[model samples]
Target: MHLNRRHFLGTGIAASALLTAPTVWGQAKPKVVVIGGGAGGATAARYLAKDSGGAIEVTLVEANPVYTTCFFSNLYLGGFRDFESLQHNYDKLAGGGVTVINDMATGVDRAAKTVTLAGGQVLPYDRLVLSPGIDFKDGSVPGWSLDAAEKMPHAYKAGPQTQLLKKMVEEMPEGGVFAMIAPPNPYRCPPGPYERISMIAHVLKQKNPTAKIIVADPKEKFSKQALFEEGWNKHYAGMVEWIGPDFGGGKVEVRPDAMEVVIDGEVTKVDCCNVIPGQMAGKIAALAGVTDDSGWAPVDPATMKAKADENVWVLGDSSAQGDMPKSGFSANSQAKVAAMTIRGELTGSKTFPAKYSNTCWSLIAPDDGVKVGASYEPTPEKIASVESFISETGEDAALRKATYEESLGWYAGITADMFG
Candidate 1:
């Protein structure tokens, strides 16, 4: 899709709705500080500012000036999209009344209700929204550390690491081996690693047909396992190999310097390796003392409010809300409910019960796209899935093409909903 300033302006205007009329404030406006500017925080910051109509002060603290979305970064690896297309700036957000600060949040004081930045600035807020995404667990993957990522890229965060992985894949030997160590359960984007494998296979099919791809997955079953397996067989048969727990995939170790992977007590030299380590909530959340021993913050399903502190809210992958996959779609859906609730609390506006929905689309090959989605409603216990749908295995090419096109539209729509 073509993007221009006018298109973004139009989309931004269309998404904006005034939730409450301009109110005369007796004192200073209620301050809202949002950390992380991905799907959840950016949408929440934008909506809170757009809907509240200057009634709430929304300051978005993000470490990066330009955000590269992890949602469609796989398409970039597959040669389906350019790296520039995956990037977005916050200029539009700044112009839309959000105070966009390009600085890292080093500390959060819950009792003081303030955030300290690496630049030595302290920001006070009446309400705080933490959507800081994920961080890798130390020593989760033996012999692999953040420093070792230079040799074996995770490419999970979708920035420099992604580019490095893509470069490595493109420059592989004609018939070299490429191995991937898939993360454990409850990681970001359940289908993400598999989608990446599909993209890598697509590239290998064109440039290096003799090349082989091996995946060591710890999970017994993954999201859309049957569909991915079917696609691998159909589009890139005999080129991909999957090792599950029954085959000792769970017992794995990697040596970045030697470029070797030990699977089930067998060492294999690989030309390239993708090591996705275990994950936890972003460090800032733990610093704020909202995250539990599980390495995720528990929140109220209805309002996305942190159960430990009502004044703080958590969203997206960092949240331990049940039944929702940790995808960009889920984060955006949760942000809307959280934004509406915050607006009501701060501006005395009308509020509605939270209803959330999400759909994740994965491209198997050129026009062969499949999807899985569900609608969710908050119960007293957790966010429960109400209804769900998925693309069938025997779907026609036309239908799969339509699914791919639908995913394209969703990409455009969601990024606009996010950055605009």
Candidate 2:
């Protein structure tokens, strides 16, 4: 059942009619419009469509026809994983009676409760869920823009850019410098940049021993700092160099074709560069007038309901959930809680206060992994941590290998839960 534009709209109308039936009086099927189809949005769509049992209408809008995860993308660059393994289809959501629209969302009319797409179609919704993810804070690097990203790939989003970076690395000359400009704190995947450097270093050691990897970071410390430093020392001594903010090697200013990173008032050029700029909520969140000065939507921790508008719910990277990191796992977990809250609110049932969980994994090498996780609950002043699941610095080689394997298993299970 290929749901073209016409069929999708028709199904939505039909679902609306069923809710208005006399026999089902007082029972209104809440119309849910999800603005992104990545981990968070896809999980929410599947759960709402399946759990509602036709009692709720689920419509998902995504710009891309398929999704490629940022997780494990470093392995792709290291030539350890294939691109196809990271791709996911939306068949499960469609089969479960979800109205999937493969189109970019242009705006969201919160007052009118309608979403405007790039094609000029408006989707009316009784309740809106936005998980559009993050967008780079352009100009954080003086001359860095979308155009410049083509030449100097950030590879942060894990798609075409990842391929471009891999190709560049493969073609670079021996003894060439592969520079990576790391972003500051409070960004997606806190440990991602370090993990990328580790993977790239692994390749450099194997393929081009003369090649050098440099990380120019704005922060003094990072995720799994001690672990990553220990691995670098034990494995690739003197092959990788990290310049912290104090070393004057981390400030970045973008040029038209290159990035100018100032370190101690001196500049060093590179053969290829990966500059990960700062990030904020996606465009759709801004369109809905839910974002504030921080460029992220604020939501009530207890309900995941937008503080700007009651009918709207924001989760994932786009929403400012107190103290929660912008991670896929956190987003997926929050979506489940959001779904339950929405269902209870519409059905006049008891609503439970929302709780969120997050676990982030970073691989130091092909068979070495480290993780940090926490669970949170709402408090009178803010959301507070309830428990921690932090992995220790030292572990047996077999344990690290098992963790790496488990990470892959987790990816498969989460992807299946979202898109089947």
Candidate 3:
């Protein structure tokens, strides 16, 4: 098979052209590439694969082979739940006919409608769904970077850092202080830091009764504040202390290795510090040219289509969801809406009306739980809320316990919806 250089080059071009060409009108199916395999991307991939009925090809790109959900991660820290309970596999997505690629997306070529994988493979797409979730804004806090996270665990995204933080808390001396610095608003899992405090307090009350937990927050008010306060008073009174934006004097600065936190012009040292910084859409979103100054992608509320790029859609915490809070439940709901819209566009059918819903649950103790939620309908410009589902501040033990149980059930159901 000795061929001239010219002939070899000609053959290569022809093969490349054939591979990139769209399948025959009725014979070839449209291809969709979904980035990220968290709640939003996984759900979108599953629905697109299943509902397309072989009419659409779905490929999902994720950096990790397995996903550990942020939902219920606090329970893991409190020793109420194990890591296995939060772990999920993408086998179901593969089984559903989606090509699950265990790789990170490097970039997106919107004009050509292609996704570049970290492995240097280019996947062409008729439509692309980006759900890369949250990325911490580097230097959002001076001296806080990925390197600093090694010493002071944010545990915000969950996984190894989360476990490390739990270990640090367990090893702290009695009466030692555990300081937590919360991020600004619009971060992933808005109620997460408060839930974390409750869970850590749960562990501390048992392991080191004299140990104190301090929250140095950037915001004046927090999600489920009254409920968390009530639970703290009932179960771990005097063990938990909150320094809101005002009381903290201002935003706190973190010193990871030294385990130091500066609040209201006062410097304090702690045994452990969990500093969660402000977050934005992942880097791939920026590379795709979909993000604005806020570091989030703006999208059409009705279709989930990117405001900047028509063929691309953004979902999850990475998307500017208008009225929707950034939570796992919101991501799951948005995924379904986006999936339906993408399918309709591919099939030449009318887009369905969009509706969104979310419920974020936080546990103050093993049995004490609280939640805030909302249901929304699409308006001409954006999604608007029509109803709310929120937990009252004061609740009986039995109701709180029931809510905790319900949170577990919701986690199971939502994970099933995403990856089962």
lDDT of each: 0.93, 0.82, 0.86
TM-score of candidate 3 on Cα atoms, chains taken together:
0.93
Answer with 2 or 3, whichever has the higher TM-score: 3
Across 1-420, the per-residue lDDT of candidate 1 in tens digits comes to: 223533653454444433233333223478899999999999999999999998899999999999999999999999999999999999989999999999999999999788999997888788999999999999988889999999999999989999999999999999989999999988999999999999999999999999999999899999999999999999999999999999989999999999999999999999999999999998999999999999999999999999999999999999999999999999999999999999999889999999999999999999999999999999988999999999999899999999999999999999999989
Question: Which should have the higher TM-score, number 1 or number 3?
Answer: 1
Best by TM-score: 1
Clashes per candidate (backbone, < 3 Å)? 0, 1, 0
Candidate 1 regions with alpha-carbon error over 4 angstroms = 1-27
For all predictions, the C-alpha RMSD in Å is: 8.0, 3.8, 3.8
Which scores higher on TM-score, 1 or 2?
Answer: 1
Query: What does candidate 3's lDDT look like per residue over 288-402, in tens digits?
Result: 9999999999999887888999899999999986888888899899999999999998977566778899999888887787888999887777778889977887767898889
Query: Which ten-residue region of model 1 has the weakest summed lDDT?
Result: 18-27
Rank list by lDDT? 1, 3, 2
Report how far residue 271 has shifted in candidate 3, in Å: 0.3
Q: Is candidate 1 or candidate 2 better by lDDT?
A: 1
lDDT of 2 by residue, 1-420 (tens): 223644776675677677755445433356889989987888888888887787788999998888898877888887778998888878778989899999999988777688889888888788899998989897776557778877788898989999999988887789888888788767888888888888888888888889988887888899878889877886688988999988755566645354445455667667778889888998889988999999988888887788899888888888887777788888888888888877776655566667788888778877888788899987665556799876677787898888888888888888888886
lDDT of 2: 0.82
Ranking by TM-score: 1, 3, 2
